[model samples]
Target: MPLLPALAVVLPLLLAAQTIEEQEWHLDALDVYSAQDQSRGDGVIVAVIDSGVDATHPDLAGRVLPGTGFGSSKGTDGTTDVDGHGTGMAGIIAANSRNGGALGIAPGAKILPIASADEKEQFALDVVAESIRWASDHGAKVINMSLGFSSSMTPSLVKAVNYAIEKDIVLVAATGNEGKEVSAPANIAGVIAVAGTNREGKPWKSSNVGTDTVLAAPAVSIVTTAPESVYSSGYAEMDGTSAASAIVSGVAALVRAKHPQMPAKDVVNALIKTAQDLADPGRDEATGFGMVNPMGALTAQFPPVARNPLLPEPKPSTTQPTPTLAAQQPVQPVVEMKDRLPFVAGVAGGTALMTGLLIALPAIRSRRREPVVSARDTPPTPW
Candidate 1:
C-alpha cells in the first residue's frame, strides 16, 4: 500500500521539488492593497479572462497585450499561454515583476490576453461575448474572469454580462471549483462571484458556495506558472476557483489602481462594501464578503471611474529578444538558496550529537545493570 496519491499534500515543503517558499501570506494580503491609495493604472487595460498571460514572463514583459483567443479552434494574436492557468492568473494580476520572483496584485496593471479555454460554445457564448464586447470596444477598464462554466445561464451569457455593466467594465468571475452549480458567467447579475480561501481561513473543498458568493480570496496550495513544464520546470501548484479569480483580478487592479473614476458599479460597490467579514458572520455559504481586503478596496470611500477617455488602445506589447549565445549562456539560478548553510550545519551537528548522547547515558545504564559479563558463563553447561 505504499502507492496511493489520488492527491494529498500538507505542504511543509517539496511542493513537487520546491521553488516557492516566499510565503509572506499572499504578499501580506497584497500589502493590504498596497497600503491605502496609490493607483498607478496609467493607460489602464485589464482583460485577462484566463488560461494565458506568461507572454515571455520578464515580469509580464512590457505589460502584455496582443490578446485574443477563445480556446478550441480560435487562437490568434498570441498570449494564449497554452494553459499555464491563464499565465498563473496573469501573474496574480498585473505582474510588474522585478526580474526573479513573481509579485503582481496590480503591479502597475495592463494585460488583455483573453483565451477562454476549450470545448467551445464559442468558448462559452460567442467567445465570452466577443471578449466582453472586445473589452468595451478596447479601453478595458477591467474584466479579469479567471474562467468557469458549467452551462445553464445561456441568454448569450446574460446579454454578455449585461453588456459589461453597460460598458462600465469590471466583470471578474470564477466561483466554480465544482462545489456544485453556478459558474455560467458566475451566476450572472452583473458578475463578480470569486470564492476560494486557504492559509487557515478554510473553505475550498472545491470552492463554490451558495447565493452567488462575491468575496473571499487566497485560493489553496496555489503556487503558480505551470504551463511549460519539463515536469515542474517553469513552475506549478494550482488549486481552484482559478486562483480565486486571480485574487479578485488583483483586487481589480488595486481598485482600478485608485478610483480611476469608479464605475463597474463603483468598483462592485467597493468590493462589497470593503469585505473582510469572514467566519460566516454576515454572508455565509462559505466565507463570502470576507477576505479580499486589498487594503479594504483601496481606502474604502470610493468614487472615481467615470472615464470616457475616448477609448482606444486595444493593442500593444512586443520586442526584447536578442539573447542568443545559446540563449545567453549564463543560466544557473533556478531558485534554491535557503539551504541556510544546511540548516546551520544541521543545528550544530545536532548539538554535538546530543552532547555525546548525554555523556554516554551513565555508561548505558551501567551496562544494563551489569549481570552476565562473560561468555554464557556456566549457563550453557547446565543446558
Candidate 2:
C-alpha cells in the first residue's frame, strides 16, 4: 500500500455521552466559533481526496456534492466510505450540525469527495494524481489530502500538484503520522504541509517534522463524524496528522469565503502569517509557524503578497543566447517565505502583517524538498 494507514485509532463514542464542548477541545483552541461568526465558509468548495465519504451521514447530508471514485469494484459515487477515514476528514472540514450533531469549522462550505484509495487504506499513486487534476478542473477552491506516501513522488504526481497550483487551488496534506520525515505530496513544493499538535498546544509526539511543514493544528482526541456501519454511534474519536490537515483545510475555506477575491497564494499567506508561533522564534519543523489561530486568520489584517510564501523562486533559463551588458545584469531572486523573514522581522518581530508592495515574487516553490526515502511493508491483501 503506497498510502499511509489510517492516521488514528477510531474509537466509537456513545451518541448521548459527551457534549460538543467535552469532545472537541481543538475547536476551543482555535476559537472556531468566533471565527465562524466572521465566515462559515459559504460559497467555498473543498475537495476531500481520500478513501471515500459517507454523504448520507447526518452531519454531512446536504453538504456533500456529487463526486467521482476510482479503482476496481469501488463502484461508489464518492458518497460511500469503505474505511470511514474520508468521512472523518470531511466531517472535520464541513460537517453541518443542523440536527445538533458534529459541527464542523466551516459548516456552510460544501464537500467534493474524491474516492481514489481503496478499503484497505491503499492508494494507487496514479489514481491520486488523476484525482488532483479532476478536482482542479471541477472548481475546487481547496483540496484536502489526509493520505500521503513516505517515498519520493512520481513525475505525474508532481505535475498534477503543479497544475492545481497554477489553477489557484489551495492544496493541504498531512505530514504523515510516523513522527519521522514529512511525506510526499505534502512535502512537494507549493503544498501546505501540516503537522499535528496536542491539546496542550505542543507538537504531537507522532507528527512528522521537516522544512516543508507550514502549520500545525490540534490532532489529539479529535471528535468527528463516522459512517454508521463503521461506528455504532455514528461518531468516532481519533488522533493523527490526518485530522490536523483537515482542520487547516476547514480554516482555508473560511479564508476563501471571507475574501472571495483573494488569490490562493494570499489565502495560504494569511494562514501562515496568522498562525501562533509555538516553536523556535519563527518557523520550526516541529510546529511550523505554530498552531492555527482561526480568529486571527479571520479578524486580523495583513497585506496580501504576490506569491505563496511556501513556494520557492524559479530557476533562470539556460538555453537563451548570451545577453548584452545591460541584459546580463544580475536579476533579483524571488523572495521566498524564509528569505523574507528579515523584512518581516524588521517591521514586526512577531506575527504582525508585512506592509508595502513586494515585486517580482515568484508564484510557487521551485525547489522540491525530498524527505529520506523508505517504504513501509504493505499490509496483506484483504482477499
Candidate 3:
C-alpha cells in the first residue's frame, strides 16, 4: 500500500486488559502526572479537527462541547466518529479516566469536535480551513489537527492558520505517518508540528520528519478510547503521529490553563524549550525539539512579552539627524615640529656660550697683576 493509504487503514489493536489500566508509562514519559497536580487543563477548550468524535463514548461523556461539522457531514450539530479515528484522538487529549477508562494527558480539558472528513475518511483542504476558522471563532483555545494531506500547503489553509493565530489560538498538527516528509497543515507556518516517539524515547519508524516538526510524543502501542462500534470494548491500543499530536495538544491545554494570559507563541516556545532532548542535543529533523514534557512546559517561567515574528520590526526614528559627508569624516590635529625646533636649539647654544665666558674671565683676573711685573723686570735685565 502507498504511504498515505496505509495511514488511512492504521487501526487500533485490542489489548487483553479487561478494565483499562491507565497507560501510565506514556503519561510518565510526558511528566503528565506531575503536571496534573499543578493544572489538569481546567476550563480550557481544545478543538479536535478530524473525522468527528464519538460524543457518547464512556470516557468522553460530558467532556465534549458542541461543535459544527463540515464536508460530507455538513451541519452545526451531531459530530459523530464513524471511522473511530477522531474518538481515539479525543481520548488521548481529554478522556476522564476517573470513570474507569484510560486517562488522558489532560483529563480536565473539554473537547470541541469538528468533523472535517467524510465517511470515506477523505479530508478536503477547503473544509479543513473552514473548520479551523470556525473553531477559533467559537472559543477554542487550542486546536488539534491529527489529519493532514500529503500535498503541498494550500492558500486557504494558510489563511485559516493566520486567522487562528490572530485570535491567539494554539494550533498543533501531526507530522504524517508516511516515514517521509511531514504532511501539509503541519508544514504550514505557526503550527506546532508533532512527531511520534516510542517507549524508549526514540522516533517511531513510521512517523514523518521535517524542519517544521516541533515536538515528539508516545505513538507506539498507545492505549486510548475507541468507538463502541469499532471496538465492542471501549478502549484500544493504537500507534501513529496522530496520537502524538493529540498528546501535545493536551499539553498545550495545560500550559494555557496554568498561564491563562500567556500568548500562543510563548506557549509553543515553552513546550519547545522545555522538551527533553532525545537522539540529538537540540532540535532534530527526526524528533524536532525532542519529546514533549508536560510538567516542564507548565512550570517553566517564560518572559511575559514576546514579539510576533510575522509582524515587521519597529523602524528607527525619522526625526533623527543624518550626518553630512564632512561631519562623517574623522578629524585629525596638525602639529608644527619645524617651528618649535629652532627655539629649542637657540636656548641650548646661549647656555653653552655663557658658561665658556665665565671660566676665561676668572683665570684672566687672577694672572693679570703677576704677568705685567715679570715683563718689566725681563726688559731691564736684558739692557
Candidate 4:
C-alpha cells in the first residue's frame, strides 16, 4: 500500500442541519451510502484532496490521516484545516464523531488528506495534477476531487486523470457552484462529474450541468464541519455540491468497503446506473442519473463481465518499438504539491488576484518543462 492523492480547491457553501434531523435528512440517506454499506465501501481508501481536514473533529478524528498538504501552512501532522471547507467535506465523507458522529456515508473507511489552498489558474492546474498522480501511484483506490478550474482543461491535470483511469482509480469531482460553465476535470471524459441537488431533489440553481455528469447528490441543507474562525455568521449551513460531492465520495468509499474487488470506475458506473430518476422520464441536464440511489446502486447487479469472444484484427505497427515496463524505469512518487501550492481561486477576478498569480508562476514554469511522466503514472493496485 502506497499513497495516491487527488483534490478540489473550489470551496462553495453547503447547507447543514444544526442537530442532524431535518425535513431533508433522508436526502443524505440516498442509496450512495447504504449501497456502499450493504456492499462494503468501508474497506477502501478514499483520498480527500481539499483545503485540509480538521482531523481532531470528534466525528472524523481517528478516521483521517495526515497524508500531506499542498498549501502554504504545511502541517507536520497533517491537520491543515484553515478555511473550514475541508473539514466540512471530510465530515460528509468519513465523519464518525459520536453524537457529532455526524456519520459519514461509509463509517469504516479511512481518509488520506492532501491539503492545498492556492487557486490561481496555473497553480490550480499543477496542484490538482500532482495530487492525482500522487494518490494513484501511492495506492488510493478512489480519488475525490470536489473542485476544478472554470476554463478549459489543463493538459497536465487531464493527463493525470487519464493516467488514474489507466490505473483503475475512480475520480469524483464537484459540478462547481457557479454552475454555468462545465468545470475542468468534471467535464473531462472518463472522470465522474457530480452535480448538486437540493432537499426537494431539485438541482441547485448554481450547480453545473452536462451530459457527461454521472449523478446528482444532496447539496442543499447538508450538514458538516467548519473551521472555528470561518463562522463570522455563526452556525454553519453549507449549501453547495461541495457537500454533495463529499457524500458521493463517502459512498464510493463504502462501496469499496463492501466490495473491495470492484475497481473505482465500475463502482462509479454502478452508482450512475442505479441512480433514481429525479427529473424527466430518464436522464436530463439538471439531474444526470438523478439523485444517487445507494440502495439501488448497491443491490443493482452489474452486467456480467463478458469478454469479447473474437479479438479485433491487429493493426500493423507504424515503425518504432513499443516500450515495455522493463525498459521504462519504475515510476517514482512526484512531490509537486509540497511548498509550492497551486492557487485554489481568486485568480480569475478578485483583489487578491495578483497574489494568486504570483503563487502560480512556478507551476506554470513547471508545465513548460517535459511532463514528469504520463499525466499520472499507473501505479500498481494497492488493495
lDDT of each: 0.56, 0.73, 0.70, 0.59
Rank order (by TM-score, best first): 2, 3, 4, 1
Candidate 1: worst 10 consecutive residues by lDDT? 340-349
Tens digits of per-residue lDDT for model 4 on 79-196? 7565555666776777653542255676677788777555432336666777888778767888887766555565666678767776877788876666565466676666667888
Ranking of models by lDDT:
2, 3, 4, 1
lDDT of 3 by residue, 1-383 (tens): 89876665552222223335344458766667788999889889999987688878867877888888997778745358766667888888998774456678888899999987655555666678899999999999999988666555556677788788879999999887767787767877678888988888888887789887878988776667766676555555666787889899999999999999899878888888888889759778999888888988988896754543322234445896644222322222321222111000000111112111101011000000000111111111100
lDDT of 2 by residue, 150-186 (tens): 5556666777887888899999998877677887678
Backbone N/Cα/C clashes per model: 9, 2, 0, 46
Report residue 13 deviation for candidate 3 (angstroms). 16
Please identify which of the two predictions, 1 or 2, would achieve the higher TM-score against the true structure. 2
| TM-score, prediction 1 | 0.28
Native-structure RMSD, model 3? 41.3
- The pairs that clash in candidate 3 are none
Error of 3 at 242 (Å): 0.3
